[model samples]
Target chain A: MTFRQSPTRWALADGRELLFFTLPGHDCEPVPDRRSLPQRCAAQSELRFDRTTGQWVIIAALRQDRTYMPPADRCPLCPGPSGLTSEIPAADYDVVAFENRFASLTEAGGSAFQLPDPADADFVSAPSHGRCEVICFSSDHTGSFAGLDFRQARLVVEAWRHRTAELSATPGIEQVFCFENRGAEIGVTLTHPHGQIYGYPYLTPRTEQMLQAARAHRTRTGTNLFADVLAHEVRDGARIVARTELFTAFVPFAARWPVEVHIYPNRFAHNLLDLDGAELDEFTRVYSDILQRLDRLYPTPLPYMAALHQYADTDAQREGYFHVEVMSTRRSATKLKYLASSESAMDAFINDVRPEAIAEMVRTA
Target chain B: MTFRQSPTRWALADGRELLFFTLPGHDCEPVPDRRSLPQRCAAQSELRFDRTTGQWVIIAALRQDRTYMPPADRCPLCPGPSGLTSEIPAADYDVVAFENRFASLTEAGGSAFQLPDPADADFVSAPSHGRCEVICFSSDHTGSFAGLDFRQARLVVEAWRHRTAELSATPGIEQVFCFENRGAEIGVTLTHPHGQIYGYPYLTPRTEQMLQAARAHRTRTGTNLFADVLAHEVRDGARIVARTELFTAFVPFAARWPVEVHIYPNRFAHNLLDLDGAELDEFTRVYSDILQRLDRLYPTPLPYMAALHQYADTDAQREGYFHVEVMSTRRSATKLKYLASSESAMDAFINDVRPEAIAEMVRTA
Candidate 1:
């Protein structure tokens, strides 16, 4: 029942071919001593693996949540004095970013465990030393990132750049991921218009897979993998939803989701800190176009889970290209794309819509 | 630009990987043709592949709707005499299980594709033969399965067994998956106390992966893979949440999720039909215990995703054992676990808590 102290491997039910990156001891022991529960829970924080196409998912157990739609009188993110939280100069903010009070990833040191097998009796700390931050998309608590103007989005992007640089400077910060969760449907506890930043201690599985693919591609083709992809999608225009000099928002031909989208830089950049002023405009405009289109697609605002990816700062194997991934649950106004047994267990997707069709519907004003 | 008529695979960001799935080629055309929105939406659907994980995802542009959540009052699964709907039997049902009107998998035949691949955009449907049945867990629409009484829950399980057996008898039906999705947090459209049953057309990844592992194990070790694992878990008591002759539930060492539990039958049973009479009491008690513990752990009911694993009806792969998987959200009542960049892009997990601590907490009951 000894779980791997680090990312390692485990035997599947067959017990022959070892599943790679298995944090072993999580299921080492049985809880009741009888072997298992009728409906017991797995003591897993996350399961990092590579999909055939190269996506990553952290199956962390303790996912961080926040309070959403709070009263105006209770301002948590704002500065102090009359404000319950820290306050700032009373002025219109264009996508202002800030540090989060509570983060799953933090500079604060804590014991993250490599859980014992449900059969085992001991636990080991999973070595995850990282930092977490929050990016305020706007000072106004009501509107969402989509509702904000392009300028506002750009400022937000700048804040991301600054934070990336700051976190990268941290000794243990390996990867910096920026993301947002909107709407109560997806368990967004806080209604404050904000996004999150997580500086990982090591490379996440998806990034590792991508890096492996990139390295493999580079070996075979002698070219940057993402650069070729960007060029191909831009020239092809088959799945391109929106485009600008800096960024191109498109629904990938092989969409893992029904309403999946990627807003990547046409020219490859490793992190937010790398984008210049002119590049920033392109990023902002394309993102704004996608957001606006997303809003118009549904009468009511949609709930979405999105992230900004970057290379790990302290990992041994770190080859990541920065990109913004926007996954909206709004496959339809009401029908969500739940990852059922087949999808979650087998890692397959049963998308109900074509990426091209959805791309065309991307409400580009 | 021409997409597959059925499932197809395409290259991803990296050339090394491929994305695969069936997405009807609704609006696609020859490399040169770029039709407007309506024209494209009218094309046949096609499937796409994910290169990273070699999984398939579909895109039916025709079914694409801006909105996904249907109005609660408009029950789509069961239509009554009110409009163009059919009603269930007038008899009182503790938990009703019925075939879905608009099923994703139908008995209707399609162009047959090969076994599987995400890169080979070569998926042709094979009579898309499968059944989708809904299990009404409770008469009370607002109450979730957690709120069900022992009798009601047992009835739901019975309904699942009946439906699984009935649906699995179909010629091509390989797997019978019975699952309940509650709470809008997990993107359940209908708030009604109902679950879903999918009699799959082909062997899902779970069965396939395990079958491969088992075959490899038999080739190497000359023994049952699950047999030794079960014995080992029985020997150790730490990770066992609960156990019974009919089912032994434990947290596996390599748990990818926070609170993931697996319920395995002491006997080698591939589906729910294998359960006898008295075995269900233990099942009911333990299941209830697990739910009670989970609900108690969190002041309110926690949001979790789970699946009842069944075997792939493939002749050689029937040796696989069925299990129930429960991955509770790693979120506390106040915060949510965001599957951001590192998680969504990478297949990795980082836990904030240890399983031993969690198991200790769960073991209290």
Candidate 2:
């Protein structure tokens, strides 16, 4: 089936943009946010360059008071009815995306700024100029994205694709990240099943590292690093969790977490925007399958973070490949593998479980 | 008064080396480990090079079944008496250091290995070659490092200094990291007041990044990066938690954690070995003071990780500086700041508390 999405845009009471995405047969009417929200204050967030580690750290003190885990009946992501006011004004919706009230970065008008020279000053900081959005998978606040139907999941993917495209085009936005943090174990403040999208003004440390590795790999082996790695995973069937015509999911050879699975398109693609409708459909199926497998691994659902690594279509990013990494801190049914001194202080990770073992278990599940 | 330590060495039943450090005039006699421990097996830990990010990951599956939170009475770290046979055989001790039973790296006597070329093969792995040790702060096991008396704290410092010197001289060892994970919130498995020292075979990612930055700083400004940073922290004074003649403790300008403080020596030192007798004594005093202050920040003891970054005394590491970073996961008395998607997956940290504010709280704590 050819999947399609229909998006209708509206504004919250505080003038934050909200977009509702629906399947072909469904329609969304723009409803006014009746809740009385204070006027949006100028973001006090600042991007400070850490001279010691050569990385950028975002300081958003206002987020300390952001909404915590509210009751299911009073979840802010839920659609608001006649009396109960929520972040969403509509009584019902399919998939919705809106600006976060307490965001680390906001859409404050600013020109694209370069990383300040370390020798220029001992301390360097600039305005955190970007955007952060929350995407709700379904109006039902209890179920996770894995529980969504195929059509609903497809709509969510469409929303992600749209946002990635739009955010990538925004001025001063260098990278766009879409990720979901599930369960309180991973510090998901909100209980509702939702994900976050961030438009970062600078390249993240991990991305930069990967890009550098890829460039070096290309120079040494004359092939794209990610593509070569994915090809190797496909060739080695031991770590393969699931393989479809359009995509493959496997446990990384050097898996950092107890339970980690990376889903990659069978063909090379820069980001979600590069995928066709059929590929997205297949991706949604495989991605959901992996999440369900992770949930079934233990008695309780796995607490995990699903991150989508995408890149722009530029010459510098020519070797980049889009993939999804789903890793869980839950090592066993009752125990969690915490990042203690070694992992937290140093960037060295010691995995308690072998990738091959986890892959076998996930494949069977 | 001048301070000195006397270290006595012994062996556990399984042949693991154990050392006891006591204050001057306090003698420790060698005791036999009466426990019928199984013969020491070769370490199963393997270091796998992650091609995507060019980082090595230690895969130690045996660590999954390592001793967890055992009962207080059965604590292996406690000094054993006549009936009980713990890791420590003596009835009491001031400070002790021993090999970890479930070490991630062991002295299997492998020659120094280089990072396998990513272009050489699809998978590259080597034996995890190094040492992992546990340092008990006190034999009482009830109080924390902050609770140790001045003489006791000084002994612990002496033990760390000795370990750093010996481990640095070990074959294939690239870095020595001394760290403590305090409180269960930070995943301290044992209730005993202790720390760990890892003699990593490879330079950690963070250390590598810092060194690269330092190299660039020296080339651009003809100055040491860490020294310049410490000078700036002292000049700014706003983020200073404490300052002494030999050291300065302050919150980094771009602190990543909610409660983060860095203690730097006034003179540039590559590692603990560079410090003299007086500097070590002063460090012990200042370090203990900061820990006490951190404990007073909240009604409950703060969950923190104290990491001591040390480098080898070599021409390539001339710009490296020794410092201690003590950061807490506790954002508030009742809240914790978990590394979510941004921080964990992308290496981008979004801190909820400002550095200056945290410094103020620590200053008055």
Candidate 3:
């Protein structure tokens, strides 16, 4: 697949790369970042290992100062006038991607995060190393991904695919995650219809669990776990929300969230990079449909997290299954599902809505 | 450990068991539940297993209608007058424990939950058979646990131990969790000084991970994971917030929450039931102190979840280690730490505070 326009790359004043993705034949004019900015953040972040569960926790103390609920006019994600500088240098662009200023992980720090000392193995510490990028879906600040036209949505998908493929090739990035946090109810600081990409230094905890489960399933049944699950959901049909030629959207039988939907491509793929032109089109269409349906369930736009799960550098592509989990905290029109004791502390989930019932709602809506 | 007064048990109007726990040698008055109540919840909840992760999720659809922040005068946790019948029958009490009216899991149902059928292995589901109970820490409507006197705290500990032991013995109860969600910020619907006991039908996801890590540690290092973690924290000293003769409170090396403290007894105990008289006393003292320190860190009482994790029925006593994880979402004086895409979706936590700094603040506070 060829894009209408190649991505134009530029650097911000703080030495962070910014890329503008435009449609074929559209021109992105060069605009320099003139605002005086620091070369790097004053605070440093690191990762620590928890011996009990063997999970890494990020400590980015500087992130406490991240912009919260900025005014729309001053939104850093939006295009600005000559005197007003934002993260993006372009006055207007189709879709833009830029490195986060207050990033939890950074590539400029070092070659890789330093491993924990062997003497104090229990108190393991490592320098936080990776990359974090913000992807603006549209130049219009008030627009959402669901509200984007087919061409705009397709462009965003292409940009995600391009980034996933490119970031996966980065020196020490083990996993790449593309996700969106929508609605202020879910603590989204910005309302500029954007998502983020985190090229993690290590495989995420949830991804590790998924790989383990898939390996176990392969050992037991000698088949792909994702393929089997998709087949089962397709055959069962009750929890299937929507389906296209190449993708199937279904609510998992044991959904942890109140409003949860997982979309799986019919054909197996390690990540977005593996998808061809047809698959990308199908994904964009089904994903947009799911988002619209979620919004229709309530009078207002649903507050949700659209998390894309894919393989890491270490894992074989066949062993990992790429899926999109769209989970909303809204339990009802006026209520939200909070991660309290059972969920936040114990990782056990007590959901108030059944998957089959939610599937029905999604189908009707 | 011998209590000053044995628990006095009575049946509520709904046929749920209610126990009154008082200081030693305190006489209890007999109060009967005269109000009409439903024998069981109007809605039935079920447990479904996700084939992908092999985790059980509870589906309690009727919980959407559960009580929100009710008025102080209509508080179900507070003691009621003769005409205004609350969940508790007594006019006033030191501490009381009773089954939840709108329980997510229940024992009133049939035997154990029915096992999933082989035919529908992918979408397996069962009745959510377990118990849910509320433990009132104080009779005052607006009281807080941190403000409770030492005697009251001791009674609450005893009540927790009592419930843990009894719930562990119940059929099909894999794990017992005692927790309290304080403040509206953490989604606590009730402001009453109370905690909850959840007799989970399956071992929680976090406990399973801990147990797996412990077993792995035993295999690889020939030692206990929890014991070694605690000893390492003690030896490190920097992260230790407070320590007594028998217990220690410290921020974990990989603390996930902005404000998190884990209290561990110097000695090993599988669950609350294993604690002797001295250990119980020490636990009460340290737990109360940590709670107070957390409250003092902020100008107002901090919104937090105090979770007591204990052994599962399937695991050997020695293989499990009981600990208390007190986590608060407060990142600063005004801003709350939100678990957006990373933490909620990928189970990767990015904390904005250093454990050592928090520990120093905790120690000084």
Candidate 4:
């Protein structure tokens, strides 16, 4: 089947942009937002440079009053009925993306300045400049991404690709991250099935570190680092969870979490933009399969963070690889692996479960 | 009054070393471990080098069955009664330190071999070679480190100094980290008021990153990074939680957690061994003060991780500085700030609270 998506853009009561991605023949004409809403506070968030670790930390004090866990009937992500208004004006929708009510970064222009000498200044901070969007996988409030059918999942993939392309082109945006935080254990404020996309003004620490290592690897072996890693994982099949023609899913050699799996396309790709229709369809299938396997690991659904790593097509980031990393804190049916002293403080992870064992379990599941 | 501590060494039933640090004129004569115990398994943990991030992750499958949250009477860190064989065999003690039975690293001699080229090998692993010890802050089973008196707190400080001196001199140890994971929220298995000390074989990722930044800072400005940071914090009094004669405790300008503070000695010091008698006493006082303030923030005590970062006294580590970082996951009285997708996956921290506000609250508390 050929995958198709038609996105129609609309506006919320508060002037936030909303986009609906519909399958072919499922055209969406969103109802006009009628509820009165107050103007959003300007993004007062500041990005402070941590001199000790050379990383930027976002201090967004205004997010303290963001939405907490509300009842299913009160979920803002759900489509609105005639009497009750929600973030979405339409009574039903396939998949939707909207600007977050409480965002860490805003579209308001904030100029990045040259950092002063460390000896002379106490801190170097810049206004957090970028965008944050909420993507609702489905209008249903109770189900999860794992429960989505092929068509719905494919739409999510298309939506992610669309957002990535658009956000990357936005001014002052250095990176775009798409991720979902599932379960209350991971502090998911809402129970609705949704994911978030962040357009960061600076490169994340993990991204910077990975790029540095990739450069070092390229210098040492004269080969692409991520490509070599994919080849190595394929050669060493001990940790392979699933190997398809287009992509390979495997538990990494140094799996920090008790359950961690990374999915990479067989061919070199920098981000979702590089994938063709068939590759994106296959990615949706593999990603959905992994989430189902994770859910089957325990009696209850697993709490996990699904991270989509995408890099821009720039010369500096030419070595970047597009992949999806899904990791869970659940170590057992009843236990959680907390990031305590060693992991949280020193960034030295000590995993109780072996990578090969977890891979076998996940593969069999 | 001048402070003094006397440490007496003993061994557990499994031949693991144990030490008791007693206050002046409070000598301890430990009873022998009479219970029959099985031989300890050698450290089977392997450190796998993560090529993507250029970091080593410890994979210790043996720790899977290690004790979880046990009942109060069966606490392993508490003193044993007539027939019960807890980890501590002694009837009572002021403060004690003992080797962990479920150690991630051991003294059973595993050699670190050179890594094969990444292009040729799928994984690079070495036997985890180091030491892990548990330090109990008090004999009372229910009280916490914050509840300790001046003399007791002094003894704990002295014990840390002695352990740092001994561990740094160990052949394979590269860094010594002393930390406390308080409250069950942060994954403290036992309810006992205790901390852990790890003699790591390699430099931690955080320490390495800090040293790298320090080197760059030194090149940019001919001054020590940490000392300059301390001076900067002192100059910016807005984030000062507490200031003493020999130490300054403040929430850093780029605070990561909702509740985070760093305690540094006024003068430069590489490790606990560098502090003199007066400086150590003042450090203990300031640390205790901060913990108390954290406890008073809400109706319930805050869950926190107190991390002590100490470096080896070598030319390669001259830029390293000794300090204590105390960070709590709690954002409000009822909520916690979880490290979800952005923080956990990308190492990008988004703090909900402002640093100056938390500092003022802690200072006033």
Candidate 5:
């Protein structure tokens, strides 16, 4: 993101400031730490770019073999609270949200990053600031979010609302991301009926971009980008994957997933925590419908990475739109939709199935 | 992405120009198609924001699934100077770079996409103005980019250079991208060793953002963001993955991939085509070394989507860092780096491994 510049704007009713950045060009100049520390990249993970989308794609490919893929019978999430142990503890509850035993975002507070000694062969890690909570979509580990009934799904939403509010209230927590990766096809390590929550310490990249764009729009036009784009998509109706009164699910103008759809508030809302109870119920209705449609689209349950886009912005980004994304990798039931080179190296995209085609499929389903 | 009333400045070698936008706002509004008469988002793929790294991420998750898993022996790309049928004949090619047969951006212009009648069940399409070409990395059907020797690799670079230039010169072309999808693990339809090229007609979302950021930097600080960042990264080498006299490979400050390494030209160049034969040969040296190291790290070849980043300023971005990115999908050759909701949604990354460790492995390998 652009540093020290005017924060990126969102078209929210209450403007919040943000910073957004475009992809960098071909310059390979090393970025100096603020402290002008000696080259310390020797032992740290650094950000890198994927050329196709001109995006900063990550490479956290861990040794899958190193993981202790536990058996389903011995699932940690299903046990009662008393049974929970150091690694896999027992937890009880129909719809429970608890801290992940092995979390990427730890509660330990420290500098955003530890400067690794360039000469050191191994990188030492510093404290990572963020919250990771697992949402028990169902008490039965065998069951999944898809198997949940309407009321149960509503409970999940209630839990989400509670957690979103709690996490957002915490200082230094910039964005609240809620998402679920279901099915082993997409590499869900845990077969438990659970989703995860991330309380970010900084504005996420997506939020940053949205906030930045919104801020710019507000500064120039006193308008909201989300409002404008949503209106356009709705009016055009080509990429509209699904829709309800409260939420409209459509293939984003720029979709990174095969069957990607953003569930935007018909009206502007900055974050999901801001949604009221009635809104929550409405959200579950539309949300379940979207998932059901996804399942019906194919015989097998879809493998997807769905996220809620909640912008953390400055007052200028008040115009930003808060939306939930359902990015399905269902190129086919058995096959995957890989983000190959053009989509990775260049900032361009080529969707084989037209948007209208996707919309029709979702609409009919 | 912001179409503001303030005259948008374009930083060129000469004076600046005020750019205006015709995009809709938060609400979808009817806007005229800049291409031809009836407007639709037919050709240009929609770009999405990657919340973690503040970059646009495109989901080119196309319907190439069935093709992706085709019988390796029957690969059309492997049949050089032969005809599958009289209608579709192949030609001799040691390292072939041809218009992709099943292309998202076809060499032949796309079919006209018409708006569906309100009653039509299927309605999804937009103007598609781009070219999709396949660049065979080797003549051997089973050979991979990793198998290629330095000379063969250099030729691949040459083919890329030729294609990039040709695509860039095309009237409708706005961005020229070159990338490779090596293994079936990532769903390679054809087993032949090959890559892809896309000549975009419009500036992609990621490029647009980069250009905008660079322009802003130029206007405010009279410097390029990439130049500054690159200089800084070089000064602090902790994230540095590999280094060549002409290029530097390092993890980005905001890397999205787990083992994502950026190979940037020491000098400012928009993309791979910018380099001459000697430079490209050297580039191939590092490129091939990295790929070899990648394979050495894992017994099985990794599934990855790599790209070459070039500026699609539509003639605007000056301070960009054009680089080649290779992100290993073998986070653990056995396990994929599953991007949880926090990663996919918030754009905030939680890399499980320290970057320094990844680099050290690569450096030693």
Candidate 6:
């Protein structure tokens, strides 16, 4: 389970670093970027703060022009010939991570973009100074991360942990968000299997709320909020999907999604980097197992989003607990949960399915 | 515009009240439901409070089996003959409001559903004691609220104001929310133009956050948050879509959707009930104008959700501001702005369109 390998890093024509992670004996040769490309700093994003809700909104107008649902042959994520260059230069690779070409957040002062405050001086507007990267789970165009071999999945975990550690140390990066949007049903532009990492300049609203809850819990009761939640779920085994020595996967007591499963490490870990070799190996196994079970829920693929939540590197550890939340909009085989006004505008969830029932189905899956 | 009328109330066979609202001099008849229907208390929802985020999630297991996309002839929201009884017992009506048969929140203690506390005793679980009602915008099933004439639109507004006043006075009701989900793309079960009013037992999460921001702004600036926001928007007229004597419609400073327009009254009205005759008439024209503009943005009908936010009856009105938020998931002619992992999981929004550009489009439409 303890496979040691270092990623071979190279730069794209746009000066975006592309890191290739492979097995010890696998090919890690650098693939030359032959096509002319703009610099990684060609575009930047504007972050506007909403006074009503007190949340920062990233406005990236150019993102509308990003690659849409391209054919498999023309997929930018797919490995291709030098003449018809795609994002990945390598014809084949185990795993890779590269700076997103159409990133919502990039290095500040890039291009001619100016970070300006709103004219009123009350509404805060700033440069979206951070990083967004694409992590290709496999070189294959069609297969998904869940369909990856055990070793390949493990490599992905390693890539995630690696990116988390590196991105957390980046300048001005406050929070590291790692997530994957799978299946075309949920607006997946590309069919190629890949995940995304967003290193945000500010703590995301959800993470801030979570930290506030944890801090309040610590102040009220001398216990970590997440630890207590995990303990409560463990005691109430009816909602548990699976458990291992290092981790437990269960439907949250008040799950927002019809098919939501939260997996937490048994030990107190603030981020994926906290997991040791044995813990990482076991964690990978448990995660892959849960994903397989989720796919079996229906005859076809179950479109889901896997989100990795971790505390900011500069933030206190007392109220931070790293966890992975995998939620699917699919309420039934023929239907998907649409987050209309109640869920979207009001931030109130009306789940048609009970947590216990979802847990039972996941368990049987 | 000064026409006055009261809704005629009647009871369905299942004990749910059905109220008919119409223009003055319109025919108001009592149409009885002859179908042997199940009682309103046959099912109820459970409210589970999530400690992590401090939000209440409603678990309505029976809603999963609620009416789906039935044929237009068999639509439950439509009025039909006595032989084939639908939800609306009336043969014809201008606008109607009735208790939702498959309500997410309903009458307290009417059902035998046990409101059990979680086994851990710390996590809160209670009977979702509130009311959910449906407001039919018109008798014609094919046309939408946007297509309704000036008189009909005004009547619909009257119905919303009536429901808000009545629901807020109900026992245990804290916040009264009025919303309309348009188009099947956003999971509208019935093609018929209608809206819903949910009398929540607690202040919704979004409303709570807005109140917090307003309170903070007041403590810091010694001014009302909403008034200041409106002033700022008015000062920067670039984002204004339309303006009437009493209402101003504009894209929010930090709009989260590609097509988002917020209409706020010029006066500091805490809720819809506070609007006077002249304000109500002006508001109706402004709202209808905005809707018409939104529909003209694309070739086909735009899928959208209209959300009405008002002050909670139980909560203080220090920071409360009544406004209507109209947002569409439609990013372009073909693309949609999906609230995937980034938005849904993290509560962070990445809007693909700029507020000013959207304003220009809406203004010109």
- Which has the higher DockQ value, candidate number 1 or candidate number 6? 6
Q: What is the lDDT of residue A333 in candidate 4?
A: 95
Error of 6 at B190 (Å): 0.3
True contacts reproduced, candidate 3? 0.90
TM-score on alpha carbons, each prediction: 0.67, 0.98, 0.96, 0.97, 0.74, 0.96
Clashing pairs in 6: none
Which residue runs of candidate 6 sit more than 4 Å off their true CA positions?
A3-5, A40-44, A81-83, A108-120, A313-317, B3-5, B41-44, B81-83, B108-120, B312-315
lDDT of 5: 0.58
Clashing pairs in 3: A4-A24, A5-A24, B4-B24
Residues B26-145, candidate 5, lDDT per residue (tens digit)?
111212212111222223333344331223343333334324445655565553233331111333334545444344543223343232222222123333456766666755767578
DockQ of 3: 0.85
Per-residue lDDT for B271-346 in model 6, tens only? Answer: 8888898888888888888899999999998899999988853446557878999999999998888888889899
Give the number of colliding residue pairs in candidate 2: 0
The alpha-carbon RMSD over the true interface for every model, in angstroms, is: 5.8, 0.6, 0.9, 0.8, 7.0, 0.8
Q: Candidate 3 — which residues are off by over 4 angstroms?
A: A1-5, A81-84, A108-120, A312-317, B108-120, B312-317
TM-score ranking from best to worst? 2, 4, 3, 6, 5, 1
Which order, best to worst by DockQ? 2, 4, 6, 3, 1, 5
Candidate that would win on lDDT: 2
- Candidate 6 chain B, which ten residues in sequence have the lowest lDDT sum? B109-118
Q: Which stretches of candidate 5 lie over 4 Å from their true place?
A: A1-68, A81-91, A108-127, A216-223, A228-256, A264-268, A311-317, B1-66, B85-91, B106-126, B211-248, B251-254, B267-277, B311-315
Q: lDDT for each of the candidates? A: 0.56, 0.89, 0.85, 0.88, 0.58, 0.85
Runs of candidate 4 exceeding 4 Å displacement:
A1-6, A108-120, B1-6, B81-83, B108-120
Highest TM-score among the candidates is held by which one? 2
**CAPRI rating of model 4:** high
* CAPRI verdict (incorrect, acceptable, medium, high) for model 1: incorrect
